[model samples]
Target: MTSVSSPLQRLADALRKDTVGGFLLISAAVLALVLANSPAAGAYNAVREFVIGPSAPLHLDLSIGTWAADGLLAVFFFIVGAELKQEFVHGELRNPRRAVLPIVAAIGGMVVPALLFVAFNLAHPDKIGGWGIPMATDIAFALAVLAIVGRGLPPALRTFLLTLAIVDDLGAITVIAVFYTDDLSFLYLIGAVVLLAVFGYLQQGRGLAGALDRSALPNWVVYVPLAVVIWAFMHESGVHATIAGVAMGMLMRSSTRDGEHESPLHHAEHMLRPWAMGLALPIFALFSAGVSFSGFGTMLTDTVSLGIIVGLILGKLIGILGSAWLTTKLTAAELNPSLAWSDITGMSLLAGIGFTVSLLISELAYPAGTVLEHAKGGVLLASFTASVLASGILLRRSAHYRKKGVPAETAGRE
Candidate 1:
């Protein structure tokens, strides 16, 4: 007799599929758009702007939207950090020669977009602050699109896109920490660093292993409260609190100990990824993507919005594809054997789907008003356009590969 799967088990299995997470994200964004534009717009705005949290000591009180962007989204960044650590330690990023193409591509992807945004906003110098808006790629959205449309494509293409996006996230985080912070709190920042060091020590089993004589306590017992304290300190430091999550995730040991099945990093990634994708990200989209298009035509013409549109769609394509081609020519790096120029083109277009971090940066760049609305409008429009275009190209490529007898099951395996 076959054993029936529990509901939790079923949910876990579903979350493992890229398509499920992608669909949930798209659904949430669409629902938010509908609510924002309909008669319920006031209710939507009220819910998003509602504030809670303690105001003393840490001054954690913030609007619901702020909580979504700063608190919940940190979980997403933790996963990004874990994936980055995995890639650096054991995956594609381990080989410098193999890594050069994606690394250069990621750099080009960020630089060209910023340049294009700057060029678009040159007449309005004040609007140039929004250049970072187009530099991010929403890995969840892009991977979901690939899962839907890129069946039968080579696994290497997916790996290329993942590595490229991971690097892209790192660049975007650096921009946030460096350019966007309003005030610096050295004491709180120093405290955060010290705690991070302690967290790293525990992750390597150095701190706890000796204390318990090798029978360590549960991870939640030790790490969860410590993580919260670190996040609190980081938040008080005036740096974006999401940076704390990334730092802690990176601190986790990626290498497995003897007799262990997987490293602490991978284990944490496995447990937290579902929450990040299913709950944190969807809630973030609900609050952040509720842009109203009442003045849609004007927003399209605005310099900031126009810059974002051009940067995300045209700039990402040119930067990523051009840099990859140039790298193949100028260096010893070569394209993956399973991929072609057309596949790279499709991947470049898909990288234009900058949703999550784009919205977060929009908030950081502009205060509540028409300008922020227009920036978000640009992100949503560009992301939709990129998804459609990428689907067309990738679907065609998938069909071509299918006809060539490539197995669809191997599409995203690596």
Candidate 2:
């Protein structure tokens, strides 16, 4: 056999790499930015506006771009759901005591951000509803930042931060399902359950201990049937359809310790990661992140805009830092392993970077309007600043460890 060309090697290589998610996500964001700012911006709008006719047999309608939110995001959620289950069972959140710090931190991170948003908007009662805007941490974006600057931090410390972000994502998904659902239809849910149950039974027959055994949710099965069922039902139900992603993901099995083929979780994550990041997310970003900056002068003054800004910045800082300290104090839970107070503080700041999830909440809260744009701007500004500061601190900490010959794995969780 002939050796592959370098370019082909890169493409084939990305197909299975863990960092592939980051590559796809960043590329999409970049593409979105270019199209939005380029002379061909009208083309970008046109693509999103394109329609995908007849979702159900009844010929219910959906738009091409909107479909990403309703359809593809569900797959994304499924992978996330599977990951959450795995974490609860075997990963960083493996035990309750071990899980407490991140959970407390996540709770604080969410609550504090919302309160800050409320603080900004409470004076204007109409803006009160947007309090949830700051309550999420975009795991992909958060991890990307960490990966970029993560070398400065010890491996264990970096892993801890990533784990916290993942746990935080689970909370965001719950909030999306519980608080963000628009309309409910029990009949559709019944249809979804039947489909999922069929999926579960078929897979359960294989007798894997956990479902996250592969890159996609199910090792031996295709998710299309289950996804179609969930999409239809979730669309009909009050919940955001992306919740279907988490649901479908939870159905799969787990990977073996030696990283053998097709653990359900790995299989699921593999299948969804690129589509979520590359195709679906790019489609999503072009539509969702496409706020017209030219309207800033008039729009910035809107109470909604101001509220989103305040909520993300102040809220995230208080929620993340305060919660960690309080949890340690009350539970006497240990702080992360081998981490000094300074390092913990630095990582806490990184938790404030709220790009991906903030955008999602904005979409859920406002769909399309000045409010969404304002929230996007707020996320970009605050998360950027926080990430920069956090990077500097974390980088310095890494240098200290390097000089002292400290190993990264020593950075422990309580």
What alpha-carbon RMSD in Å does predicted model 1 have with respect to the real structure? Answer: 3.0
TM-score of each: 0.89, 0.79
Candidate No. with top TM-score: 1
Model 1, 1-414: lDDT tens per residue? Answer: 545867777787677666777777778878888999999999999999999999988889999988988899889878877876787787766777667888899999999999999999998877889999999998767887897787778877777887798789878977977898777688999999999998887776665543532665666887899999899899888777888888887788898877779888888899888888788878877887787877677897798889999999999999999999999899998776667789889999999999878988898999988888899889989999999999999999988888777664343222
What C-alpha lDDT does candidate 1 achieve relative to the native structure? Answer: 0.84
Best by lDDT: 1
Error of 1 at 83 (Å): 2.5
Q: Count the backbone clashes (under 3 Å) in each candidate.
A: 0, 45
lDDT by residue for model 2 over 1-414, one digit each (tens)?
Answer: 667677655564564343565556556666776777788788887887788777666234777666766666565566667766676676655756646776677788788877777777877775576677777776656655566565645554555565677667767766776777655567777777787776666555345533433445653455565567667776676555665666666666564555556665776576556556556555555565453344456556777766665655566667777787877788866565666767766777787777666777777777576666766776666676777888787777777777677667675332
Report how far residue 247 has shifted in candidate 2, in Å. 3.2
